[model samples]
Target chain A: MADRSSKRRTLRLKTPISAEDIADFRLGDVVYLDGLIYTGREGVYKRVVDEGAELPVDPAQVGNVNFHCSPAAAVREDGSYNVGAVTATASFRFAKWLDRWFEISGCKVIIGKGGMTSEAYRKHLVPQGAVYLTTVGYGTGALLGRGIKRVVAAHWLEDLGIAQAMWVFEVENFGPFLVESDLQGNSLFERANAEVAKNLDALYEGLKPPVMSRYGETDDRKDELI
Target chain B: MISTQTLQNVAEELMAKAAIEIPDDYLAGVKGMAETEEGDLSAFVLRAMLENYEAAKEDRRAMCADTGVPRWFVKLGNEARIEGGPVALEAALRRATASATHEIPLRPNRVHPLWRTDHNNNVGLNAPEIDYSFEPEANWIDLTAVHKGGLFGTDYRMLFPGDGIDGIKRFLLDTLIAFGKRGLACQPAIVGIGLGGSKDTCMVLGKQAACLRTVGNRNPDPRIAALEMELKDLGNSIGMGAMGFVGSSMVIDCHIEAGFTHTGGMPMSVHAFCLSSRRATARVHADGGIDYRTDPKWFTPYMRRETVEWQTDPASGARSA
Candidate 1:
């Protein structure tokens, strides 16, 4: 249980988030975003960063965008929103967009599967004061369980399919899961590194020579990359 | 001895079942998170996991699409046996392996080293992989199903492998990152990690870790418990935000499992749970007492389990997507 619902830092937008109007939100105030959090993964991200606000430009204003999510709804008839704010499934897109995505869309949350470039980390996490919270990996049903209010609007869903559709949602606190992101500029990965160092230092020392491959574009693994 | 084919079959079927009916305990775990999550981000993470649970339940597909390479670990009971399968565990495993390739439709995760798409997805060299170490007890094989999403890139995302500080942890982290990069380079998603064993087995275990159930509602392994809290913290640091962006939420979760490998060997393997994060598992008794299956209603609120929740077409074997 990391930081799920903390005071949301409010930022004025060049766009609107939903059909509903906005309220004054502070730099750090816990706010329940129930109107319309858009769903944009690989397809949507590229389109947004490339195209720049094609839709009504409503969802473009929000700070959160669930890229790793399944699908989401806007609201419940009774109002409280059948929300599904889960973890990030990131990693589908390239690292270059990491900063641009935040800069262009005003996305505070990017949910999906993996991590990003250190450059993006410093540029966004520290400067913007945004945080990423990781979720339990297999928690898809977690998204579907809260039950969706309504399929607000799915762009490219038919074309992109469920995995890459752009879904707008009226969500709850969405997570009490993993802090893959944090405004403090902290990361769950940092925590794991410390432990991995403590536990495997010896083995690492032993297998020093050959097996020590490079990461991403650095070394041997590069060959494995398609 | 239980042939590898038998083991393979059992593992495949069990995996298929998990895809179909996720346990009530797991469901309850999702409920547990939904009910009591503290941090706004963590709560959001929990809700996401539950959504995965819902997807597993209602979509009649995997919770995550990675579907991991089918793996099984058997605890043989002294009085128990494989009943009527082949001889060697390898054979049984192989047979089950083949059956699974056809029956489960699990994404043939393994690609040819050079060929890439040339993969049949399975049935390749040592396909439907199996790893086993027998206990003193003979006969009865306690088959356990485990499938984990790959957690790659996180360690590398943060650690400075090229920082010239060649530490074992750095090396291991770097190795996982390379694989993670490959996975992302292949497909960006939640990469499941497993560590322990000679360079190879640990790698297998990492994939196995995602398969290991979240300690959320189940019994806890002190080591694993510590790892969970720690991994959660470390994962975000790598800057692999929610879904690999620059946000704090990077990995969904780095579920892990370990075994007593040789004291000297610390093999770590990582399986990348692509964004699809597809996965599911099921257990059936000798009499076929099925333990669980994904409930369709679990995915769509619009769809109810009891009311008019249509089931997967039995004949075609397709669930209500």
Candidate 2:
């Protein structure tokens, strides 16, 4: 394990990541970030993409990195904020909003849990020159929280509430994310899944099928539920 | 009588402990898995998780940002009495949940399903579900807080008696492989299997088996215990590990809880308590003394009584009513 991990490359890139910076990134490379990143998911996506609500903060001002997350946060009585452990949500569910989101937000990096499919990367992210970095452990929330230097602002707290609100953060060394998808749409998870799938059929060799079967989206074990 | 104040205070502390601390049994299990994990990426993930636990403890913050849907499991001693009745107990639990959500600054994950309303607190309609059980010959209440992730790695099926163990294995593999991909289910988990119950009961038992029981603990029934070991080995044998990488760390432990069911049907459910595996328990004595611990010790002999009457001597295992 150590030998394999030793061979993997690690990098740290600043926010508003450039095409040149991410172009050489390979699937499974470790990455850390420095500068501003904002949180947005279903609520923010619906408000801006579907409901036509203008973004409360300009994308250029906040930088182009978007995190699919909500912080364990609270607002103090003095109208200040207390932001604790920060972790990512599954990014697959937001694939639908990606195209429009990229158009509106100019996001160049997507940090989240469970990287999107390679197809999603090719269609939605490749054109925008964006890449996906997944949080380590599907989290490392407390470590990530320690990386946060300050909460720049939180928008839509009244309307969307804390979980759904858009939060902009100032961060430094803010990740231990793995590069799940690269510029050419190659995905680390898909590669891993393919290798694991090779041994799957043999595991069920003698296990007979159930007497009763229910309707499902797919019966293929190799296929992902996402 | 236990005062509502003590209950509320203990409940609040349990909430924080559940969110911030990785219980010892689970931590030890993961450490063992990490040592043996061969997949490079999987090993890296395990190492990172270990570090994250230390970070959480040092910083006094939640181990996972998605803090999961907070819920309570209360065990009341047959002789235990609260200053107020069940209604007041419920209120105290709710108040503690709300207060801790703000204090621990837990992410308010609960919402009004259709309307999408957020209370900025975990409290809501049927939220923070409190489950109950009773223990004989004691005068204390046990409060266990389980912060289990709400998505992926769970499934239910109605299998016939004829389906047998092979059928159960198939379903387990199916659920594990499906959600185990991309680490969606957060593999290397404590996988719990619920067998021989009605559909809802199957779901509940499976969840309790995962969240309430500690690692290395086995069911009382000898046959069930052996099956648990078999399932645990079978899960780890799947060439999958942390983050769905190819390796042998899919399950750190497996637990099964069974119930008498319909004669013709053997319903089953599978639940995965993920990498975080957040839970903490406290016993509040009638004299208002509180004792905190990691293990829930929920499945007592009396709770799993096979006969119609409570007849077993808890201390001696003798048959007496």
Candidate 3:
């Protein structure tokens, strides 16, 4: 095993994080959370944002951290929840819902798989004092699961089912997330991408383009697919 | 005869194993990558992944919450007999998939394409796909379960023979760079390239190549094996690593599986087996014996046979046309 100690700045935060709490957070800093976080994605977003349904639980009570996730969870025989692992899904797909999600949920922190674009952060998150925290390895489900002290509640079981339902969790030391986007809308991934893109021309210098090109294929390597 | 009861039991166990355990081959490959990765964030991610694997084993929980879309590949021995034929075998596999989904608590990822109906189990229309292959001169059924993430890190393209290897390299780079941003591919992955066959077959072969073959395993063909090494290096040289950080750890390994295709076309597909890279295998013999392993050994000599007829040299057990 390689050295587990990370040289990057690390911070522990409590959920329902205040503006001052994340004000100093910088891109590439590590973060872990304590308190409560709720799972929500397309299903919860569609219900509350598009369908105009009210949130099942008050955001003030549940804490303002929203996780772009669905747990590997099940309903027990007695109708209790059994959550074995929890990991974040890609957050970019949920960008459309974030503006309304922030207003409705009062979410100050968004935790997910891949962070949203810097453009998205500028538009939707920064105004609401939210930052994007991306989960480590993108598959650190077991480690994250160990952080969960208990399942606080699982709403919409009948409507959205297990994977898509809103499951609130009480957690401690519950992450190994990187601060992908900070208050200034600076993105760690975009910064890294800019650096990597500089070498793309040389990497593909000798390789010839395909005989048949797909329609609308961008020649610019810096452009992101999402 | 192999009993349906035995098949189901083994299938369920294989599902749990695939979800929870990071196979030793993959673990070693990632460990090697971690040691050499220089990017600060990328190295941190790799270290975290190593810890995550241990945490998964210790807790007996799925390594990834995505748990991915669970599927099976069964290689049957020609002489093997089953209790109720292929129908029973399929049913047993399906039953095991559903039961394990609830018990192991896999995210029910499969949904109706149109209506979005969820059975709350990982089974639905054509879900938990069971792909099959056959082996010669044996009497056991090999069951391999692979749980691969359904989104991102896979692509297909049609290329002409005139384009050649350079075109293939360009496509690989394109796919890697596109999805590699923000690490959407969940990379530091095992990249598998399918170089021939019709469009669909090309896709299948690429997926199997990525999910079935262990890290450092190569194609039997010398030229193709060399290309695998070259591609692995080319991918790593992209100045990308885990979470698309600026580092040289984009690919832990590269594999290529080819099939006969239209003469004028060299249809290709690419697949990335992500960080979790979940898979497990088991063999159930006719005499009620069961053996478990991480390696599927899916690409046997028989599987890669090139001629119309397969023949084996009796003296050395070498394959001959």
TM-score for each predicted model, relative to the true structure = 0.45, 0.97, 0.96
Tens-place lDDT digits, model 1, residues B1-321 = 334444555566666564445455445544543454433533444455555655555644445444445555544544444546324655655555445544433434454567443243345665555544333323445555444333443332222223222333354345444443312312223334555555555655555454443323111345655665555445444433222222344344455555455554444445544334333333334343434333211111111123345443334332221
Local accuracy of candidate 3 as per-residue lDDT tens digits, A1-226: 3454546788998878888878989888888999988989999999999999999988899988889898998888998878888899988889999899889888899898889889999999999889998999977999998999999998997888887889899999998988889889989999999999999999989777678877549777776543
Which structure is stronger by lDDT: 1 or 3? Answer: 3
Off by over 4 Å in 2: A1-3, A217-226, B314-321
Q: How close is candidate 3 to the true structure, as a TM-score?
A: 0.96
Better of 1 and 2 by DockQ: 2
Q: Quick one: how many clashes does candidate 2 have?
A: 0
Model 1 TM-score, 2 decimals:
0.45
**Residue-by-residue lDDT tens digits, candidate 3, B1-321:** 999999999999999999999999999998998898878778889989999999999999999999788999999999999999999999999999999989987888888989999888889999989999998899999999999998999999998998899999999999999999999999999998998989999999999999999998888787999999999999999999999988888999999999999999999999999999999999999998999999999998888877887775434354321
Per-model clash counts, in order, read: 164, 0, 0
Candidate 3 backbone collisions, by pair: none
In candidate 2 the C-alpha lDDT for residue B256 amounts to 97
In model 2, residue pairs whose N, Cα or C atoms come closer than 3 Å (at least 3 residues apart or on different chains), thus clashing, are none
